[model samples]
Target: MTVVVNHHGVSAADVLTVARESATVSLSVDAIAAMTKSRSIVDSIERDGRPVYGISTGFGALANTFISPERRAELQHALIRSHAAGIGAPMPREVVRAMILLRIRSLALAHSGVRHIIVQALVDLLNHDITPWVPEHGSLGASGDLAPLAHCALVLMGEGWVLGKDGHRINGGDALMAAGLTPIELSSKEGLALINGTDGMLGMLILANDDLAHLCTMADVTAALSIEAMLGTDRPFHPSIHAIRPHPGQGLSAANIFRLLQNSAIMDSHRDDFEHAVQDAYSMRCAPQVAGAARDTLDFARGVAARELVSVADNPVVLPDGRVESTGNFHGAPLGFAADFLAIAACEIGSISERRVDRLLDVTRSRSLPPFLTPDAGVNSGLMIAQYTAAGIVAENRRLASPASVDTIPTSGMQEDHVSMGWAAAVKLRRVLDNLTSLLAVELLAAVRGLQLRAPLQPSPAGRIATEFVSLFAGRPGPDVFLAPILEHARATISGRDLRQALEAEVGPLA
Candidate 1:
């Protein structure tokens, strides 16, 4: 099925399909007509001898300089070639696809004044699986994502390189020619229109932000299961307890934990066990406060990113009344701040999970579970090393959690005085994800080990399903056996599985 770009409204789910799943893309017919009409106004303005930024004159620090009509096309081509200076390792193919889809959506708004054929060529490239080789670095995300997107514009002119379906780099001109596609000659304002937008940073932020939302929900569910396995108290998540100070996230988290352990016979049986006290440690008791704050932070970031998705975010917007106006919409501070918030949220997930893992390894804190949860503690240091790994990852996450938005460096000889460093924000989001995934994996493995010792008294219905999922790859792990496979299985369990769907299938929609 063809995914339509409606310009005014685009969903996070659609971005996922086009970016990660290679969904086909096309522009709405009305949007195409709108772009044509907008470009006609731009033409009329140019024909009337009116001055406009990046149209009749130069750009950035050189904005005051005028361009002769004879050098117009050469100027457009030169802008792309000279700005295609992105360096470092290539971005993943999925990110490149996302950049293409987002740019097409922005142009479809008709305010960028790009020609219809330029947008059509981008659509054709998406349809034919001809993705440009965009590097991951070199974008300060102010004055737009200039360098990386210039590489995207380079592919439109068939000037740079692209990866074919066969996974080999070939000249973009040859690749387009082989596929019966002609190179596009960029018109006035078309080169700047294509590259001067926040699509690249927005694409990465949207996907990463969505994933972090899911991770927050999953973190709560997984933490509940870990609490049960470790024989911790349920009083901390009680409705009355949360209702008193009711932060929305804290209340929602309390409800989630209560629901996750609703049908547990073990928890019911332990209510009167005075040895297990009314209160557990902070890691178990404060799960709601810690995880909920992360959830609230993600909610804020999602709102910021969604607003950015529909914004024009281009330099020199073309007006409907035949005028060009240079503006600062291309600056990426909004996206940069949102991405930094998401990175901090993800790091907190790892931080809290590391605490739980530490508790599980401590014999005194772990209730009645064996040391390191191993049958033969002396000979097999089972899961002893796992705690060390969790600590290391938590340290790395702390380093990554340092906000990229707080830092800025000037570019373009101080003309582009303040940069967003948003590419750093985007790249750091990926690192935070990796650290959180590994941290959660370690927590799940340790939780399952703790649960095995509590047999005969089963876990709650939600916990039962999670226990069964882990049991598929690891069954009450004994001493002197390889633990690598079990750790990998635990990673798969939490990495991309739809935890909310799994919960809904067992219990109803979370209230």
Candidate 2:
């Protein structure tokens, strides 16, 4: 798919396509016209010789200093070079790609006063698969991810490094040359325009939002399976029970669980049995409440990402009314708060999932299923350690849940104080999501085995389908034989979209 960049109307879905799917992008004709108009305004201002924040003067703490016309080009170069002081390992290729795409989106708005050719250079790099080597550290998430973005801008000047299609590192100048592209010379405020934006943290936010939405659905699927495996009733998921609360996410999660348990033989087998407990544990019965809250939090985060998609996050924005003004749109507070909130939500989901796994593994609590879901309880360890793994990941997620947005440090000689630390929040949120995937995989593994141990008492149609699909990778449940490979395969299946897509095909769509 080819995404057309314009002054407005870009969506998070569009960013995902270009960032993760390697979709090429082009500037719209309207975007070009806007760029020309904004560029002329920049030129007129420069001609009047008034000191602008980034055009005729230095940046950050040096904003008060003025430069000669002949030295302005050097000033731009120095800004990129000095700010390229990020210290850490290179960021992932997908992250770099998303940052580049988003930066293009910001510049395409024509508010940053850069020439259309500079935006085209970025697009060319993306189309040619030339990814800049942005480091993992150095972004304060204030003033628009300066250090990391500088590395990206350095590549435009053919002065940094890039990763080739084959994943090998190549010199930036050589990479551009091989792609039949020319290196751009930074002019006036062009360098600042290239780096000053919330693209880095915003890119991660968009990607994480996509992943968490899918995982939220998966949480519903796994929770339903666990309920059936433990002989729990689905009555709590009744529509009437949730209608009183009326939280949108709670109702959605309850509906998903209720629908998944439809025609469930396992649930039906004990529906009238006198020995069955009147109420199931919170993990099984209250699954919707916990998972529902996570969904609500994700919905909030999604709104933040949507708003940022069209916002211009630059210091000195060029207005359509021919006036240049400084703005705080570059601050990362919104992105930071969203990322941190998502992390907290993810932790709760994982926490509830781990509890379900614990229930499935406990013989005393597993409702007569063999200890740890194994036939020979004493002879085989069974899934005893799988619960341990889930617990470990859940603990790690709790730690990763610490909000990075609340922490701050002054920088640039105290000229820039109270940073957002949003980049750190995004990075840790990624870790939290990954940990959630692994723990959920553990829950899925345990739930499927518990369902199999239920024997002739079959699961719901949806559970059976999920069981059949997982069996392909998890192999038949049995004695503890080489478990790592099986667990890893289960993780891969859960983490990717395959399991959810496969389930949706049979059960219709999950919320």
Q: Which structure among the candidates has the greatest lDDT?
A: 2
Model 2, global lDDT: 0.90
lDDT by residue for model 1 (224-296), tens: 8889988888888889998898788888888888788787877887778886647788888899898888778
How well does each candidate superpose onto the true structure, as a TM-score?
A: 0.95, 0.98
Model 2 error, position 402 (Å): 0.7
lDDT of each: 0.82, 0.90
Minimum summed lDDT over a 10-residue window in model 1 is located at 495-504
Model 1: residues with Cα > 4 Å off, grouped in runs:
7-9, 164-168, 498-500
- Colliding residue pairs in candidate 2: none
Model 2 lowest lDDT segment of ten: 161-170
**TM-score of the candidate numbered 2?**
0.98
Candidate 1, pairs of clashing residues: none
Model 2 regions more than 4 Å off: 165-168, 274-277
